[model samples]
Target: MKKGSATVAQLSEFDEIIDVRSPAEFADDHIPGAVNMPVLDDAQRARVGTIYKQVSPFEARRIGGALVAENLARHLHAHFQDKPKHWRPLVYCWRGGQRSGAFVTWLRMVGWDACQLEGGYKNFRRMVIDALAQQPATLDFRIIGGATGSAKTRILEALAAAGAQVLDLEGLASHKGSVLGALPGVAQPTQKKFETALHAVLSRFSPDRPVYVEAESRKIGRVHLPTELMEAMRGSPCFAIDASREARIEFLLRDYAYLGDDVADLQRKLGCLNRIISNETLARWQDYAAVHDLPALFTELVDQHYDPLYKRSQNSNYVRFGDAIHVSTDDLSPSGIIAIADAILAKTPVRADAR
Candidate 1:
C-alpha cells in the first residue's frame, strides 16, 4: 500500500504513472509525463454521466459497473498481460476517488504494486496555482525592456545559451506579447496549462540568482500574468535595449516573415485595432499589405502605434524604467544579438552564490 504525495518529486518516484481520467480531461491538462490509460473514455464517460442524470442512480451504477468490468478485462489482457508481477505504477483519477480506487483495487488483486495519488490531478493543479501565487516573490528578476522589434526575445535566448537563467514569458504563452503577437497556425495552451508550464520552469531556478526575462505587460494575448509575478517584474531592475529605426524595421521584417506569406492574416490583425486607429488608417495599412509593402507599413505602425503606446505604458507600468541600464546596438543580426547578450552579462553581476 505505497502512497504518493501530490508534489512533483514524490510523483516522479514511480516506475510508471497512469492517468485514469477521460481523454478529454487529459487533453485539457494533466501531469506532464503521465501516460493516459483512461478508466472510461470520453464517449463512455459522457454516456455514464447521461445515464446518472436521466436515469436512476442505482441503474446507472449497474450499467457503469458492467462497463468498467469489461474495460478492465481488456486492459489486463491487452496492456498488462505481459508485465511481471512486481511492476510498480502510480495511478490517479480526478479527485483521488472512486475511479482510481476501482482501478487500484483490480491492479492489486492481480498482484501489482500499484499506488493511488493521494489527491489526484485536482490536487496537482491546486499546488501549481498556489505556487504561482507565492513563488515569484522569492525570485530576484532582471527584466529586458525595449520597444517593438528590439530583439528582446532573441537576446533572452542568447542569454540562456550563455548559462544564465531566463524566464521567457512570450515563449511560455506562445504569444509575442503584443497586438500582432499571435503566431500563425500555432495555438496557445489553456490557462491551466500555461500556469503548469510556468511553475515547472520557476521551480527549477534557485531563489538567489537573478532570472533574466523580457519586459511584458500584465496580459500576454488571452492569458494574464500571475499577479505576484507581474508586480515583481514591474519593480525589478531592468536593461533597456535601444536599436536604430532602420535596425528595428529590418529586425521586424525577418521576425514576422509569416505576415508576408499570408497578407490576409496581416490585414486581419491590423483590422483589430480599428477602434483605436481610424478605419481609414487600417485600410491604408491593408493597402500596404496588398502591395507587400511590409517594411513601409511596419515602419509607420511602430512610429504611430507601438512606439507611442510603449512609451506611455512602460514608464508608468515598470517603475524602474528610468534607471534601466541602456544597451545600445546598431546591429540587430544574430551575431549582434549574441553580442548584446554578452554586453548585458558583462554589466549584470550574477549573485556571488549563484556559481
Candidate 2:
C-alpha cells in the first residue's frame, strides 16, 4: 500500500506507530502509546514556520525538507533501521500530510512496507469519539461512593476479586479524583489518550455485568469524561461508604505522603485549594504541615476541602440515588467493607443494572 493510505482498522493492527506533530501538540493530547518522532524538531519547525509566513512556502519546504530528511535518516539508523524488515509500524503526522507521508516515502526506499495513517491523529480521534458515543446506554451501572480516605478503592478491589466485573474510570485515567489525586511519579495522559484508554477497557465490559465506578465529575485532571459515561453515572444508583472521619484522614495521608516529605508537592497540589480555602486557612495548612502536625492538617483538609467538595458534587445536579445503602458504621473495618459490598450487591446485580 502507498504511504498515507492505510485505514484506521488496518492501522490498529500494527505493533507501533509514530506521531510527527509538534511536542506541544503531542503534550496536549495524542495516542497513549505513540512515541513522538517529529520529523520537524522544535527549532526546525519554528524556522520552517517563520519562512513559510515571512518568506515563501517554497523556501520553507526547501529548508524544512532537508532537515526532515536528516532527522528521518537518523531515526532509521539509531532506532528503526535494524528492526524486522517486514515489521508493521504505522506512521502519522498531524493529518497524514507531508511530514509522515514524506517519512513513508523514505522508508519505502529502505524496503519497509511503511504505510501511513489515512487521516493521522485527526481521524483516530474521530474514531474514539464515535466509539464513546456508542457506549451501552442501558449499562448496569453502580456507584461506589465513599467519604474521603475510606479505602473505597480497596473495597472495589475486593469486589472485583469476588468476581464482580468492575469499570474503574479512575484507574483507566490514572487519577484519584481530588487535589491529592495525582499518582506518585506518573504523569497523567492527555484527554484524548484517556478517552482511548477508557474506550479500550469499556469495550470489554458486557452490559449484562454490573460495573462499579467511583463517583466522579466529567473532568479528571486535564481529561474530561465522555458525555455518555457521565450521563450513565448520573442516572445510575449511588451508595456511599461512610467511614469515621479519623479513618478517612489517615488514609488520605498514607495515600498522598509519597508526593514528598518536603511539602512542596502538597503545596503544588493545593494550588487549586487556594481558590476555595481562605487565605488564612491556606497559610495555616502550610504551617501545620511544616511542624508535622499531620493529623490536624488532614482533618481540616477533609472538612474544609475534600469532604465538602465530595458532598456538593455527589449532591447537586446529581439526583440522589433512589437505591442507596451504607457500611455499618462511619469507619473502615473489614466487616464494614463487607457490609458495604453486600449492600451494593443487593442493590446492583450483574446482568440487569450496569455493564
Q: By TM-score, who's the top model here? A: 1
lDDT of 1 by residue, 171-271 (tens): 99999977788998889988888888999999999987889999998889988899999988888888999998789999999999778888888888888
Pull out the clashing pairs in model 2. 139-354, 140-353, 140-354, 140-355, 141-353, 141-354, 208-351, 243-330, 244-330, 244-331
The segments of candidate 1 whose C-alpha lies over 4 angstroms from its true place after superposition are 1-9, 351-355
For candidate 2, the lDDT comes to 0.77
Q: In angstroms, how far off is 108's CA in candidate 2?
A: 2.3
Backbone clashes for every candidate come to: 0, 10
Q: What residue runs in model 2 are displaced by over 4 Å at the alpha carbon? A: 1-4, 136-138, 161-163, 264-283, 329-347, 353-355
Report the CA-based lDDT of candidate 1 relative to the real structure: 0.87
Per-residue C-alpha lDDT of model 2 across residues 1-355, encoded as one tens digit per residue: 5533698777568778778887877777777688888898888899999999999999999999999989988888888856788776788877889998888888777887778888888898898899888884756677777767877776787688777878777787788877778787778887777888887777778877778877777887667888888887787767777778877777667666665475777766666678788889889988776676777888888888778777766766346554556654564556666666666677664444432
What lDDT does the true structure give each of the candidates?
Answer: 0.87, 0.77
Candidate 1 residue 9 C-alpha distance from true site, Å: 5.7
How does each model score on TM-score?
Answer: 0.93, 0.85
Q: Give the C-alpha miss distance for residue 68 in model 2, angstroms.
A: 1.6
Least well predicted 10-residue stretch by lDDT in candidate 1: 1-10
